[model samples]
Target: MKTLLFCMLGLGLTACGSSPKNAHSNQDELAMLVGTYTNGSSKGIYTFRFNQETGTAVPLSSAALPNPSYLVPSENGKFVYAVSEMNNSTAALSSFSFDKETGELRLLNTVPTLGADPCYVATNGREVLTANYSGGTMSVFPLQKDGTLAPADTLFQGEATGPDTIRQATPHIHCTVFSPDRKYIFATDFSADRILRFVVHPNNPIPQTSPEAVDIEADSGPRHLTFSPDGKFAYLITELSGKVIAFSYNDGRLKQIQTITADTVAARGSADIHLSPDGKYLYASNRLKEDGIAIFAVNPENGTLAKVGYQPTGIHPRNFNITPNGKYLLAACRDSNVIQVYKRNEVTGLLEDTHQDIVVDMPVCIQFGNYSARTKDTKN
Candidate 1:
C-alpha cells in the first residue's frame, strides 16, 4: 500500500496543493466523518464540524449507502476509503472524493473485494488493503492516478486454526497495518492467533509475506492495533479475551513485552486501541460487558502499560479517536447510535464525560478529516 499525498506527488497532480505560500494549516475546526452500519436507522457515512478547542461537535452532512463500517482518509484529506461490510455478492470497497472546505463526499468508484465482509481496510498511500473477516482473506487494490482505487487484483488467504475451535476454525484476518517506516505490512490474523507480516513491493499487487511478526495468545482474537508516536511501541486489543498486549516494535519486528486485562477479556469484546497524542496515555475500548473505555498510563522509559482508570460509555463502543491535540476522546458507540465525547486529563491519564453526544444511527467508525493531521502513519 502507499500514500495518496505521495502518490499525487509522483503523478504530478496539483489537487494535493495547499494555499498561500503552499501551506496547509490545520484549522481550529475540522470535519468529523463517521461510518455507520445500516442495519438500523443509520444512513451510512455522516460528517460533522468539530471544534478542537471547545471539544464540541455539530452535525454537517451525511452520505447514504449500505454498511460502510470502516473508513480511512488520505494523508491530504482529499479522499476516503470505506468497506461495505456485507456478504458474498454485495460486499465491496468504495472510494469517495472529499471536499475539505464543505465536508462533502462525492462517490468516485467501487470495487469488489472478492471476499465477504471486509471489516478492515488499510493503505500505505500506494495500494489499498482489506482484511476480509468473513471470507478469511486479505485483498489488495492498487491506487489509481485520480485517487480512485483500481480493481481488486490480488487476494491473500491463510488456512489455520487457533485454540478456539468455534471462532478460529479458519483464518480470520481482522486488521492490516503498515510499519511506521511504511516498508512492511502487519496483519492481525485473529483466527490464527498470529500477526502476519509482508514486505512492500512498491507497485506490486501480489503480497510478499515474511514470517508472521508474532503469534497472539490462544483464543485472544486480536482485533485492532495502534503504535506510539515514536513508533517504538505497538499496542493490540484482543476481542475474544479483551486483553491489551504491548509490544516493542522495530524495523517491522514486533516483540511482545507486556499483556494486561481490563477486568474482562474473555469474550467481553475489546474493539479498538489508541494512544494520546502526547504519548502519555493509552486507551482501549470494550463492548458486550462493561462497554467502556479502559485508560492506561504509558511508561516512557520502557514501553508498557499500567491500568489507571475506566470511563463507561454507550452501548457497543466499536471505534474511537483521540483528538490530535489530545484534548478530547470520542467513542463511536454503535448500538446506542451516538458518538460519546470525553475530556482527557493529561496529568492523571483519565477521562470525564462531557455529556456531548453526536447522535447518529449505528456509528461504528469515527475519523477526523479536513484538518492537517499531525504527522504520523495512517492508522485505522
Candidate 2:
C-alpha cells in the first residue's frame, strides 16, 4: 500500500550530494530541510535541500517508511525523530542518522509509542516526548545509545471538558513542546482547549510526568507554542479561535498577558505559527479563506503583537518553517503539492514571494537542520 502511494506521489528514490550547480554553491548556505509525506498509498520520508542564496530547493533523498508526518531534528542536528501517523494501536518513533555533509538520512531503529496515532514529537537531551492525538495522551520515551527509542516510561492522559461537545468530548493531545529553559513540558490538548504543563526531572521514575501544573482556558484549542528568545514570554497559537495568545513567563509559570487574532476581520482558517530568531517578528499561516501568511511586529517590552500585513501563499498551507539564518520562510502547501519560498524583510516584518516552488505530494511539515563548518571543510 505504501509503495503504491510513493509511485502515485511521483517521488523518486534518489541519492544525495548531487544537487544542481546553482543549488550547490560553496558560498550558499543550508537554509532549510523540508519533509513531506507520500500521497495515496505511499509511506516514507522525502527530504529537500534548500539553498538560501537562490531560494531554490533540490530533492536530496527519499526513504520508504510508514506514514512520516511530523519531524523533529535533534538540537545537535545529529538525529531526526519522526512519527508514523498510523492507528496500529502501537505507534512507534522511528530514528534516523542524518548526514550533515550530504543531507541523507540513514534509518536507525524504532520503538513503540505505546499509544495510537502519535502526531507531534519533541526531544530534550536523552528523552523524546510525543502527543498521541487519537489515544488522548502523551508518552515519553528514552533515546538509546544507537538512536532508537525505548519503551515509553511515562504517559500523561488528557482530561475532557469543554463547551464544544462534539470535538471536546474526548481528549485529543495536539502538540508537546519544551520550555526554552527545558524546565517544563507544555502539551496542548485540542479537545480540552487547554495547555497542560509538566515539570521535568531527569532522575525521576518517570521523567516526563508532573501532576501539579496550571491549565489554561477551555475550548481555546491550543496548537503550537513559541518562547521569546529572552525566555520572558511565551506565545501560543489557538486553533479554535484562530488567534495568538501571549503570556508572561516567570520561573516557569505562564500568565496570560494578551491575545490577538492572527487574521483580519475579513480572513478565516487556521495554520501553524512561528517566531523569528531575533524575537522581533511573528509569522502565522492560514489554511482557508484565501490562504496566506500573516506577519506581525513584536513589541519587545510588553510582548505584544502588532499586525503588519498578510502575504498570499498556495492552497492549504498546513505548516511552514524559518531558516536558521532568519532570512527566509518556507510554506508547505499540502493541497497545492508545492513548497513556496518567501524572503523575510527584517526591517518591515513582511514576506515577499521568492517565486521558487518545489513540487511534492501532501507536503505537511518543514524543518531546518544546522549547517556545520566541519561538513564544508570535508566536502571541499
For candidate 1, the 10 contiguous residues with the lowest summed lDDT are 1-10
Deviation in Å, model 1, residue 335 alpha carbon:
1.1
- RMSD, model 2, all Cα superposed? 4.6
TM-score of each model, in listed order: 0.89, 0.89
Give me the overall lDDT of model 1. Answer: 0.80
| Model 2 lDDT tens row, 235-257 | 88876677888999987788988
Tens-place lDDT digits, model 1, residues 1-380: 11112112322222222222123235666677889999876678877667776666555556777899998887777789999999776899999987766667999999999989988888777889999998888888988867898998877775567787777887788888888888888888888887888888766755695445588788788888888999999999988888899999888888999999964635458899999999999999988888899999999989989999899999999999988788999999998877888899989989988776666778899898746344243322
Residue 271 deviation, candidate 2, in Å? Answer: 2.7
Instruction: Provide the lowest-lDDT 10-residue window in model 2.
Output: 1-10
Candidate 2: list runs displaced more than 4 Å. Answer: 1-27, 41-43, 264-269, 374-380
